[model samples]
Target: MNAKTRRLVAASLVAVTATAVLAGCGSADRGGSGAQGGVLKLWTHNAGNAAEYDVVEKVVNDFNASQTTYKVEIEAFPQGAYNDAVVASSSSKKLPCILDVDGPNVPNWAWGGYLAPLELKGGEVPLDDQLPSTVGKYRDEVYAFGFYDVALTMFARKSVLDEHGIRVPTPDRPWTRAEFSAALADLKAGGKFEYPLEMGTGGSGEWWPYAYSPQLQSFGGDLVDRSSYKTAEGALNGPTARDWAKWFRSLVTDGYMAQKSGSSPNDDFLNGKSAIEWDGSWDAAKNVEKLGDDLLILPPVDFGQGPKIGGASWQWAMSSNCAQPEGARAFLEFTRKTAYFLEFAKATGTIPATDAAAAKIPGYEPGGRYEPLVRAARDFAVVRPVTPAYPYIASVFEKTAKDIVAGADPDAALDEAVKQIDANLKLNDFYAD
Candidate 1:
């Protein structure tokens, strides 16, 4: 079989497995008893993340203590294996009533009938108060919500920028494309670091789309046409997209960034190996600890369409097969309290979803050290494409981006990627409305 055929076959196998899994799980009446009576199983992707797991455990314990009607039992899975475990359990009709889903996958799982629409009454955490990207919606209905979300930013040291005469950018006055490139050149000229910028290219999987796609969008191109969600024909391979590809490749070719950066880009930044690091808000606390007052969380540069950053983090949702959705919803609602949001943000070093929650957190409050992150999320965040075909889109983009950065012809690689993406969307009937 040809390469396309192999990819098709692999995609087909995954679809068939997903279908079987959904069918098996859907056939049962798994939603447990009502809100007042029985155990509600909750699964989370925090098995190895001790700090996050502790917060989840505390929430479950608090919920059980607060209610006589339901007891929530918890199961944790490692982030890498969580999705597969959920799929396998779903195939066997053994999925938990409540589970945590990565924000981007919420649309896919909900479309596949793996999740139920969330039911929230008026004045429950004020959905309006939460960051726009934290609420996972599909087809105009919310399927999940998260207490915290992460923001992407360019990390640098104020002292380095000041010493080098590089202007520090902020949310209101972000660096223009020319200025950003000039800064990189200036940093490189100093000969103080191995690379002027660490793009975190060593990270794999979702990190590719999450980290780099925003740069494409900022250049006035997108993964797919949002108006129809039908194809990536013009969007993925358009002129602006080509510019993004070329510029991205130039970073490595010009030696401004490493083609394959070290394992921990943040560590490298702290260790003075790189002048700037493009990373997530989760690294803010550590960067601050090491750099003290010198740490600078600068806004992303504006290539053209203003600055843009990836949004949405892990969120909670009810399983379609859950017999006790109300019970599960109760637990979710309880966990959305401001105190819990503050607790999770403190524990995970993530941005709280709500303003009220942000106020309670030390560095996240208004005018605090990490407050720029909240502004970044509010002003520049862009959630990944909300389509059932997103997984395929992300995978294709990841491979094509890596190829482009490795010196593949920009137009040719993107064109081929567009072709593959179009084919996948068509095969799936455009993931029809």
Candidate 2:
């Protein structure tokens, strides 16, 4: 966290009286020696494991070593602080040359004039192959470039499932809500697992939305009505959404998922305390590394209607205040065009954003534990809302899902979510009705 960011967040904390904590959000301005030759400063919020950092460092180092025209210096920061830091740095005229912004922040930053349009004359970032949903539009103009691909998938311990006599769902097959309920009940009856499901609670703001997003889709509900950009008047709280909330709530009320635990949901599954872990494709890599070939990945659960698969594309963007914008664009283009993205995919244990990278990287093998995850990622991937106010909108759904799981009344929860979202939409100047 930098001084400017701390000051801004402190002021916002006092004013809003809301949990908009973006503390420790900015990188400690690091740069390469001899800016006389034009150095490109890069700041990234993706703080993967230590090994992942090493891979990124190596890539940056390789880039610096390969070229002498301009040195690229990379700085890291926590994801929580990224947007705040970027916003603060831009205000202070200390923004980095290359900025890696997330999906929701991309549009907001671009629209706010804090980021330079990648299509500018000197902007040479190739976004032709990127996902249209992630970085395609920004106030009717495109500014960011999507790089990495992340999709949701179901993860479970194969040993626990087999011990409980639970048949694993097929790679291409999705289980209806009834079949899914029975599996959890069977696991509970056999006493093989204390909880059949465990959703991570690292931060309710981020994890909770994902837990219910897939179900929302199956129920024929969406977070934001693409056409209207409002949930209260939209289908987000429709029958499909109601069913999802009720069913998910039952998992906690009926003692299927951890309700009051502070530890990670994945930790519970790894300890054999839970039968399944619904996580993103990123988890496939961690589980494979943690449990080796013993883990089983399954397609997301179907609501009898069908499962809703969601995914997002990661992007790398150059800031408007960057001194060496051309150099930063070169680096961005390199990461996307070269084998760097493929290396990133393999190292980070995620699917590549580009079709070319997907073809080059090692894929899940047949009969493997992750085959189902790979299949699910491919067949049913849905990206989140790409609107400028997406994070705020996602919060509406997250809070509602959390309340429902905690045994709150379904109708009351939906009604409250609708009310709160309407208030926020109005405050944020977005349309709610």
Candidate 3:
């Protein structure tokens, strides 16, 4: 799509405006004794996930109706502008009582003392049944919570597979890179598709970490060490990294995948231009609507080692400066417990966080058309490193991958990334013995 078209599409997808309340939220200041006695602000950007806003509206309305101590005002913000607004709000102490924070933003907000630590309140739902990797931690503290979990998996048009007599890949037995390359070649030879795969472009490391990392991990590579911030000591610069870089460069160099124009791969797949699109399960709902019921998904390509891990945690955190930490905790508790979140996930195509919720969720099956795509969240989930300096480390990984794909030397890119990461660690006083 052209730049103008892309922007238009993006704007359409993310047009969310949060309604704010100025007065009658109670006269309690943030830290005043009236902590539990004011208007609470809640913000989120998952409008595309589901259309059941009324379900949540009822839940919040119920909470408001049931309480006299505080009133919660819920608002929706455009996903593109959400983070900036959060940052700006942090500066003026205008931070909401509850906010939807991305995994990467967890550490920054936590360490910067912009958010309050969460404390489970009365009537809080048990999250022990949730995926440990999904609702677990941010810098060793549980800040945000997610109801829907997403993973990167392969997507194919059933018509294309049938036309080429190609077997769809499965989770237990996924296609090898060689097999994938052959399938793409066959499809193109028959004039079925212009490119074999639709790769993601630069962003908040969403699609790249999900769709692209699998190829690298198939070859035993990784973007960054989830356990440690150091790239030199871990998996980012090893043989796997080099092999992965070569594989990616081959797509552009060998004329399989098209040149990266910074377009969304999901759109390409939906429009029938690309046969295979590497993206997260988060796009499943829209794809199903656009591409039809014949959509077949494959697990991450198995590179002989094992399936690569791909998925990110969406967390909810309390502001450390929150005037009513107790009230904030209550809000988080309500979000997780009510039927609101489960219904919300069903609409969005996100994997449910809790196993019980996952099981109780209507229409969840073992191995069907949409199963591989949804179950990918369970089979190949990998949490990004939970550290104060992770944003810097994540940047290093993204830049190195991009540079190597653009023809820069793999070893050189890794080395530079390592230097930057190490410097960030030291600069942040995160140096270890």
Candidate 4:
């Protein structure tokens, strides 16, 4: 809650309750500490991530050198502390003109008046070429856009799968619910590894929902019903959701995985301690580098519903109270260049935001080794529930899922999750504010 994570339970409460304390959102002359009118300040949460920080620095340097109307100064903070800093700045009315936000938090920030809807003129950004999940939209209004997105997939060794007689899965024909279970069973029975799967069950905060909820969605359930965004109700406790929870728990009960995996699931997979490791694309390159052609980056499983991977990452947006709103928009527009996207994708080893940019990246180009990942991102990605209350809901779902996986009754766990979510929605007046 003290940190700036969108799935932070405490931060979610702050996001909803602290709106009154936030300075009013409008075109005000109260700007940042940068030089007067001609200077616009930009903030980033990449202080610890050298690769992404360098990419942000390169973009700002080029943008500043390319223009005279606005000089965008940078203030980079460590990711762990960045979100909290934004919240504190917003309350004191000292937010920078431009800032990057976690995609899931855009609705909360926008609805709370901390962010303004983006106003990119026609063709300013290649919105069409960008992956749908990279654009952060809330209530039908564009709020933020990222230069890249990360996809989730399973990492396996071809040798292990072949030894276990597990069929390799593709995006078009992913492992069904039964097939995936059988594969895990085969791996477990082979006795080559203590556990057949490693899914980073040790992860916390946002990772829980970002990694697990998509499986729930694939089972024809979600953290909440997107149609209303008001409550969990049938979405969390319904029959499909119950089935998903049972399967989720069965992974541990059936000896397919650890209730809490090792701190480094990727390393476990790389060491052959686990036959399959369900993880995000951010870890794919290192695994690929180590295993080379033996590494298998497989798509998510199809659980009655189509296969899915959670989408959306960090994205840029203008603060609602920016003083030089026009300058802010100008810098925002400048960031749309495909070249920046290419640089970002290269710098971070991530999937490019646009296909044009992806074509420029070495491994992500057409028919390249990483090409299936890009296709998987396009075909299977699903953004989390788009609502101001999403942060709260995500937190609740994380706890509920953990409880169920630890052997709590699925029905009781889901019912508790639904009750908590509905109570929060009612407390916030359904986030109508």
Give the candidate number with the greatest TM-score.
4
For each candidate in the order shown, give its overall lDDT on alpha carbons: 0.84, 0.64, 0.64, 0.83
Worst 10 residues of 4 by lDDT: 20-29
lDDT of 4: 0.83
Is 1 or 3 the stronger prediction by lDDT?
1
Candidate 1 residue-wise lDDT, 120-157, digit = tens: 76435777789999999999999998889999999999
Best-first order by TM-score: 4, 1, 3, 2
All candidates: TM-score: 0.92, 0.81, 0.81, 0.93
Clashes of each: 6, 5, 13, 0
Residue-level lDDT of model 2, residues 51-164, one tens digit each, is: 556767877888788788877777776666556666655556667777776665565565454567775443223455544544645656667765566667778777777777
Give the C-alpha lDDT of model 1: 0.84
Best by lDDT: 1
Ten-residue stretch with the least lDDT total in model 1: 27-36
Report how far off residue 421 is in candidate 3 (Å).
1.6
The model with the greater TM-score, 2 or 3, is 3
Q: Estimate the lDDT of model 3.
A: 0.64
> Which segments of model 4 are wrong by more than 4 Å?
1-30, 33-35, 122-124
The Cα error of candidate 3 at residue 192, in Å, is 3.4
In the range 1-433, model 4's lDDT, one tens digit per residue, is 2223322333444343433423422222245733376888788888888988998988889889997878888877767766766776665467788899998888888776678888787444567779999999988899999999999998889988887788999888999998998998888888787788998999998999999999999999999988888889999899999999999999999988899987778888888898888898888889989999999989999999999999999999988778778888888888898888988898888999899889888888998888878988899999988888877887888899889988999999999999999998887667774
Clashing pairs in 1: 30-323, 31-322, 31-323, 31-324, 32-323, 32-324
